[model samples]
Target: MSTVYDCSRPQERKDGLAAAASAVRSGQLVVIPTDTVYGIGSDAFSLSAVHSLLAAKGRGPDMPVGVLVGSWSTIDGLVLSVPYQARQLIEAFWPGDLSIVLRHAPSLAWDLGHTKGTVMVRMPLHPVAIELLRETGPMAVSSANRSGQPPASTVDEAREQLGDSVRVYLDGGPSGDPVPSTIVDLTGDEPILLREGAVSIEAVSEALGGVQVGRPR
Candidate 1:
């Protein structure tokens, strides 16, 4: 059985966060809560850990995972560039349900199952997740559920699906939304909507000054 942490209690939350950080450092997978849904994550810099996370989810390499960052400046360290429009979107909707995909910095040595040298990134809207990210630096995260299955909304659901595959599960109650983040590919001249979730197309388009393009369903 996985080591589950009750985030509702103050002491347990701290202990759980510490344990989760240690697990990531030791190249183990962790299941944590995000703004949109429960997520399974691992240290973004750990190639073996990232691979383990993917294996746990039975996910394909083509379906890239998103990295959760604690702050805006951290974004520059990971992605090659953050466009002006993209920055606006981040400023407006970040710490919420907006995820941006950008060209990965060739200098960084990490595997996140991305193709064409790009990676999806987000700063989740949950305080617990932010606190954990602040400690772990950055985490490669995907919804805590099997590929093609409905995303896990509660910690119990995540436990049911992920079980012992993950070393720790930070129980932050249910997620803010059952849907995933609105994924926007900001690598190109025009922003492309990869997946529509909490943020609407019109809002994203306006944030990008009318340059939003929706991805094909």
Candidate 2:
């Protein structure tokens, strides 16, 4: 059975977060609440763990997993480059709900399920989620639910879908926002808005001095 931790208590929150981080380091999955929604995360560098995460989510290889990082250095280590324009966007709405897809650093060995030499990275604004990410370095995170299922708005909702598949559940109450992160692909010369969610298309375009928004694939 998964150990569900109530983050309402200060001490329990710390202990639970520590255990969650440990789980990620040991190749175990954990359901964490982010600013946008609840996400199931595994160690980004663990190839096997990433595969397990995909299986748990019933996700296919063609669908890439987005990455959650604690800071810019972690982002730099994972991606080929963070363009100045992209950096502007990152600065403008990071730790919130904007995900930027960048060219993956070839030397960094990690599989996020057919990312096609690119990675979608985000810095979420949730305290518990960011704390866990900082402790775990980086994690391959996907919304907490089976593929095509509505995202879990609360920890219990996530627990219902993930259950024993997850080692720990950090309950941070309602996600507050059911909207997913705005995904902007900056791997090419032009920034492409792959999906619009919490961050609007106009905001992204303005941050990059104007860019194209594409229909979701």
Candidate 3:
């Protein structure tokens, strides 16, 4: 059986965070609210949990999952070497709605799918998400919906799609609008805009001192 916790209540929020953290640690999936949309997440280092997350979404390794971190410093440990531009972007738009793709540290023992030695990472601006992430460390997360369906904006919608696949649902109320985080790929020589979302391309360029953002592929 699965559980849903109304995070609006103080006690439920505390309990939900505990349950969600436990679920992640045990290689089970959980749904949590992010600044962008509801996300289904599992322990980033657990291959079985990652497989379950992908299967629940009807997705494949080709469409790799992204990782959500709790703090600004977390990215430093996830990537091979945080580039200067990545640092600038983190300083300018982190804990907001920017997701950056960078080369993962080869020493790490996790697989987020056919990421080709790279990983997309973000630091969300939701307190519940941050609280849960702090307890669980980095998590493999993706939109809480089937591969071709709309992203979930509430825990109810997420539960409807993911069902018993997710062990816990942390309801942080309605997620307002479902704007996705802007994804910028910094794995190449020049920064590339993989997806233009909540954050604008111009803002990204401005943050990097007018460096041209490459067109989406």
Tens-digit lDDT track for model 3 on 5-111? 99999999999999999999999999999998999999999999999999999999999999999999999899999999999999999898999999999999998
CA error at residue 171 for candidate 1, angstroms: 0.5
Let me know the TM-score candidate 1 reaches against the reference structure. 0.95
For model 3, name the residue pairs that clash.
none
Query: Which tens-of-lDDT digit does each residue in 98-158 have in candidate 2?
Result: 9989898999889998888999999999889988888999899999998888999999999
Model 3, position 182, has a per-residue lDDT of 97
Candidate 3 lDDT (Cα, whole model)? 0.95
| Most accurate candidate by lDDT | 3
How would the candidate models be sorted by TM-score, starting from the highest? 3, 2, 1
Of candidate 2, the 10-residue stretch with the lowest lDDT total is 208-217
* TM-score of every prediction relative to native: 0.95, 0.96, 0.99
Off by over 4 Å in 3: none
Worst 10 residues of 3 by lDDT: 172-181
**Candidate 2 vs. true structure, TM-score:** 0.96
Q: Which pairs clash in the backbone of model 2?
A: none
Candidate 1 clash figure, as a count: 1
- Distance from true location, Cα of 146 in model 2, Å: 1.0
Model 1 alpha-carbon drift over 4 Å, by segment: 212-217
